[model samples]
Target chain A: MPPAHPPVDTADVFALLERGRALSTPVLRAAVGRLAPPMDTVAAYHFGWIDAEGRPADGDGGKAVRPALSLLSAEAAGSAPETGVPGAVAVELVHNFSLLHDDLMDGDEQRRHRDTVWKVHGPAQAILVGDALFALANEVLLEIGTVEAGRAARRLTTASRKLIDGQAQDISFEHRERVTVEECLEMEGNKTGALLACAVSIGAVLGGADDRTADILESYGHHLGLAFQAVDDLLGIWGDPEATGKQTWSDLRQRKKSLPVVAALAAGGPASEQLAELLAADAKSNDFDSFSEEEFATRAALIDEAGGREWTSQEARRQHTVAIEALSRVDMPEHVRAQLTALADFVVVRKR
Target chain B: MPPAHPPVDTADVFALLERGRALSTPVLRAAVGRLAPPMDTVAAYHFGWIDAEGRPADGDGGKAVRPALSLLSAEAAGSAPETGVPGAVAVELVHNFSLLHDDLMDGDEQRRHRDTVWKVHGPAQAILVGDALFALANEVLLEIGTVEAGRAARRLTTASRKLIDGQAQDISFEHRERVTVEECLEMEGNKTGALLACAVSIGAVLGGADDRTADILESYGHHLGLAFQAVDDLLGIWGDPEATGKQTWSDLRQRKKSLPVVAALAAGGPASEQLAELLAADAKSNDFDSFSEEEFATRAALIDEAGGREWTSQEARRQHTVAIEALSRVDMPEHVRAQLTALADFVVVRKR
Candidate 1:
């Protein structure tokens, strides 16, 4: 057995993410560099390695949480972190692929405090570049030329399918008259949980870990992803716009059937009825284009008063605890477990 | 050696395509069936298996050329056609994936004599279902659980990347003032040639054909695809709309920088100059929306007068010859060679 280091603090989670970036960035860049012209530039811009003009820029590439999970999972399987770099890069590519397409589908103009790919380039390139990245992810894994790599690729593709399914459901829900809390949870689980579950276990699979151990890690990640999404949902509604870089009561404005709204609607109280009526009216209002921030705030207040906020917060905490508890089923160094625990804590309780 | 059959005619080529469909459709349907909810229905609609209302309808699905090529390629490599089924299904999925996305990207309203996926479904489901099909393509290949499958998956992904790259160039060309014939040919090669080449050779690869044999088949496919696209470009401008299932002078109407247009522009004749001026005027024309059928016909006449139509026809013949010559480099049954040659003839000369 490997020697255990001291318990890791929350700061180590950032270090793990940084290390993931450091390790996976070079390979990721190399793989992306293989793309044909204009696509190479567009992908580079999307990754924040270059400005829209193709000039170098220091931009906020997302925190490499999935990659970090991959590397740490590999180490947790008693393998070198390098064994996981391919898995890390593959998952990261898949993540960005979803982001590029998602931003376009949702018609979001900004990501990471920068203009989204579709906004900067166009929707066509966004679709094409996203496709290229997904292809690259599969190429990267299969190029490893091992049976284990094939297995990992299958997991990645399965997660990708689930992610797409979730997006379809999410889009469908926008036109839906009502969505159950259970349906929302299932969608979120597929959208976010499946990918994270793959990220956390794929490296170990690549490292030749048995199915049982990988399953445990996958369970940990699935719950953590749900928790992470719950926190994001909270931020979408109640968190400060300054902290979240989103508009106040963003989910309320969009009428997203997110966890909080679905749960609140399912709660069946007078406040829930009020919240539902307000949302229905907002959705059908002739003055929808003229709906004021104050109106949106009123809707947010109704959702909050319906206990959506508290229920979501408690759900996040519950998922977080379950995620932490799952670590006990796997054999890993104490430091890795502590680090994974700390990351879950950060995800569940993050302000933004 | 297998028994050599009678020399096959054009009728046999359709039979080949039908046989491919017969073998691959079940597997393809099964893979698509695995998709969730609306995506399943959406994909079925796109595949012409079902109408927009989710009722079964015999809509015009594609001719299954890629799958046909795959099965023929495996047979040409001295393997059973069954050996190529996975490759066939994988390429068909990739082809449909590109179609689903490209229809949205190009904003085309109709395909295969019916509404495109994005026209019937929303753009969001189009994107999601396209992504899911692509993921499924990779999954299908990798699940074969062999080194050959892994190798085939790499080839598939590489071609997929090139396809995306080609699409990017195609979109970029729309905004540019000029696109050289060479540049246009390169884009078409990536957009149309890469995936076709993958389809034709991937089955051979999966059949464990040696690199040299696969390379020869790939060469044949590459040339055949170029020939096929040249014919398509010709049809885009000059063919019957009823036969081609497109608008009259479709390429000129969209200002698509297809082969004929680029070649005509580069010919530098008086007609070329006139054609160039008219196109520039059209691009700058605020009345582009009001451009009549007569104006479009005028552009088509100028392109024809400039020898664009003849050049494209000659290019198609040249490519067809090159493709048939490529078949002589590798030894297969005489009937197989004849069948392959017949398919090339059909593609180079098809109205659509």
Candidate 2:
């Protein structure tokens, strides 16, 4: 209903993220460089550090959201962000590993306005490089050689396993006729929430936070991750191609069973029936190209009429509230808490 | 070249392998069971514990040679085989992770007398399950939670990296027209030797062996792995389908540039030229099935005529000798030494 806390300064959070990226990118680069050639080259390209031809190119790797959260969680635990660099690098690697493999699995050829690893290097190399990065993540944690290394590795591994589980469920969902909202949420929680939770918990652990604080940070991350995915699904259906850096109506054209679509399907009304009929007709035609702009517009309108859009927006706001509440459970410096709140607000509200 | 050690009792070595398998398979199964279902189902089917329909089947998972080596190394270092069970389980998981992913990448439909994970579960599931298992391997090592856990994980990660590197090189070699014997050996060393060496060294490290003893054991495993691959290449060319569970001349039919084929091509003689011509002709035809049985026989004869057969056999024997000598460098109980020697002997001499 109303805001429980004052609005956070989004610019400050972005600045912190930039600061986090600046601190972690070199460490991430050095860790990735340890891989043998071709793998290292592919990784560099994936990170937007180099062109496919190996020349330097300016590219945005990602928003650095996970690492920023890691750094902020560390600061909230009363440590400098530098103490969380290992955790930050690790979460980023795991994130990229999932992205590289997910692109191959989903057959997405474009990532961040460039060719995906599989598109450029072939699927075999893409698969191997993803694996190398996954291994590199663990090796980096272990190489830290502190008592915290073992615990950090364990948390990362658990999160990674959940991420794989969520991905598997996501793939399975594409083939299913209908998926419940509850199931969709579970899958999203595992797929997106686990890593985000791990990012926060790892930072807290590394920053010498007690178990209670780490658990609270993880809760904050879990809700924030759900909010992030909810907004992402919304963008997939409605955001401008120029802003999202993807083809217009790409997910609908591919008949992706994203959360919004699933929620609408589960809504069970005349609008839901019409939306189902449209999707079924598209499936029968088996020609994605034949679906014109009018058809896509109609489909988007039907989704909204079925209350999917409203449901997702409300869910994102609800999760954002829960995320902020979790942050309040831990007593931290006022500034650090403000930063975490800003990140949560950003997760729910980002347009791209 | 003469025997520096007496011949090992093959029966005793097989018995040891059986014991190691019995101890480690349950641990492996429990570890694998921790994965979410469908992934676990695919894994169980891949392990040959069940048929495609999930019914129990009498399927041999593998020879469990690596686990046996781990156990034997532990014993040689004055610990019980159970002390090496974690290492055994970790090695087996890494080995199977490779098998699952390699099958998908190489388009192999069959393995261990059944459809591969990718063939049965699809590439997406196969990829995710392989990732899960790889993470599981590291998780298992970390859960051991002793001071040794970090070292064990570091070694496993290093070996897994080399293993991935080797697989990448092997894939690259498939595209190249020619590969040197040295390069082939280097690839094989990374592909096959790294895991085997890790198997021995992990056991030694867990068993409290000093650096010298672990190094010697690792040396033993390196040569033993080379010998194992050499014999395997030989089998690919000449082994019977009934015993090897593969088509006759399968590697040649697929135009695989395995070690023997590469060595034959490098010989640069009349036979080598003829073999190259035959392969080039096959490539031009683009119909592997069009090759008559007589043509296949002729190709096999050319490999022999080019000294590929003799060279592979000689290399196997030489490596077998070297493997035993490395074992000899480590002074252990006489019986344990005999078991390691027997295992090495068995590796180079197995028919299938």
Candidate 3:
């Protein structure tokens, strides 16, 4: 049978999610409102709820998934839903902050089928918007107060530092001609896994969970992030752009050092050599029109022949299995456990 | 006789300054220590305390001025010195965070006679270092755990938002061909004034100051910032590069829409028209080294004729007067008032 939409039931998650949204929206709005008019416009553009004129627009944003994960962990750890809500808002703000800045650094023009903040507002404005989001994220963390402050603040800071480390490594890899599989995994672990681990750990901490519970929750989140990133990598190469709304093999065009590419490089054979040639060519090609479709196909075949796809998929499944095992170690309600399992499965298996 | 250094007589402010530096150094080191081994190496270089290999180097960093201001305000507000130290450290972190990122955006190559962070560590690593600084700033704020989570967090968030708003305006002004005197003031008010204002306000808030005292301190800092920025603008055009270590009239070469430029632009006439031509020529001048000193002086003369220098100095004096008036409004020790006044004098009169 096909997986249910949203994977988990989301009843509990959404309840906390809505509360966070309600709490944060006004706070965000008030802060932005007080800013100079131009900065206020940039902030609105980042939220995707307003046009440059500050009027309401199509208003679709990414799924507040990370925040929900954080809130759910906090709830499952036995904290009141309200108790963990500030962190919910904070993690979401930080995630969006990263997205805004990352899009600029990567020169990504489109997100959610619309112009990125930088695309519409320009790069400088986008950078400031990201900065504002980052500042607000910290402010929200501070709001979580003293009892939860120690752990949550520490986790958030570490996560933020790791996120930048990951991005730095990712960008550095592009300039280099070679990379190892271990380097790629470590990069991904810092970039994607740091925040996920923080989300769950913060939730557990705020929920009054014991240290052991927090550790187990953190493990679950770490593996979940790895699996999620793997699925994202797969989609970058193989998923339908129309469904994912991402550029077609955008990573390939950019010669991104993703898992599959890194894996093929590590195999060290003729196929790997061919992959390298394609990468070198791609680096020089201003437009895809310069490369023949057959050349693209040949490169794809080389990656497959080197067992890059299979290796990546197997690693992803291994992470998912480990995540499930970690979740099992936590003593939560049966329904919550099932929900988390579903969420983990969905992360590893999703096409988009 | 030359004025006595206020640090000699201002025992409380001096002690707080020492304590602030002590608290900040450890926190900053601890946070940077957690960076990935490679990233840590780069961070060390960026902090001016180490070589590329993370070996200790001379002349490590600037005076912790922002933290000192914060700590002084906290003490003046009657908060226990220990309780307020964290807030002071947080502001310093935020200041350094801005400095690191600003160097990247401004394409600055040198700081304090050494290579700028980005010049040494590369842009990607430098960006991460800045992000780390920002994260640590938040961590410091979060360390002030108390039952008043909501209010405390709100204040921190508000201050951070102001900081970003100021930065946005600063970046935005760089690209503008024209800006008003009011707009320039407003921009600096956010960019420079806001953080200084927040430094005092955060200290006051943490030190258990009455809202009235916070308001007074905030006003004092705000006006003081205007004086400082105006003086900086004056120096940018007229000061000795040997003393400032900045290119003489470099702001003119860059066609910066600073306070003097804005004032000159506002005082439109034949002089202003000549100033505009100078700006146009600057825009086309590809090589700073190629321009003769005679031509640079001639162009600067046009700006001076347009009343740029005089108007800016007059405005600086006006702002300083307001700052002194605000200082009078604050009910503090006579010695503390004298110390703050001395600092204010230092800001307005500094050549570098």
Highest DockQ against the true fold, candidate: 1
- After superposition, the stretches of candidate 2 with alpha carbons farther than 4 Å from their true spots are A1-7, A280-285, B1-8, B208-212, B280-285
Question: Candidates' DockQ values?
Answer: 0.76, 0.72, 0.43
Predicted structure 1, TM vs. truth: 0.95
Winning candidate number (TM-score)? 1
lDDT of 3 by residue, A1-352 (tens): 1332335544654554455566556655665565565867776777777865678985655555566676567677766555666666667778877887788778787776677887888766666677777876766666555566556766777688778878878988988888898899998988898888777778778777777887788888888899888878877777688767677766775678899889987887888888888787677777865665576567767887887887788878878888889987878877667766766766775566
Better of 1 and 2 by lDDT: 1
Report the C-alpha lDDT of model 1 over A123-160, residue by residue, as the tens digit.
98899999999999998998888888988988898899
Model 1 chain B lDDT-worst window of ten:
B1-10
> What TM-scores result for chain A when each predicted structure is judged separately against the true chain A?
0.95, 0.96, 0.87
Instruction: Write one digit per residue (lDDT tens) for candidate 2, span B1-352.
Output: 2233466577887898898899899999999999887888889988998898999877869788999888887888888888889999999999999998988998877676677888888898888999999999998888877767677777888889899999888888777788899998988888898899889878777877777887788888888889888888888889876677667887787677888898888888999999998887777776777878888999999999998988888888888888888887877889888787778877776777
lDDT of 3 at A108: 84
lDDT of each: 0.88, 0.86, 0.72
Stretches of model 1 off by over 4 angstroms after superposition: A1-8, B1-8
- Per-residue alpha-carbon lDDT of model 2 for A247-271, expressed as tens digits? 7777787677888898899899999
Model 3, residue pairs in steric clash: none
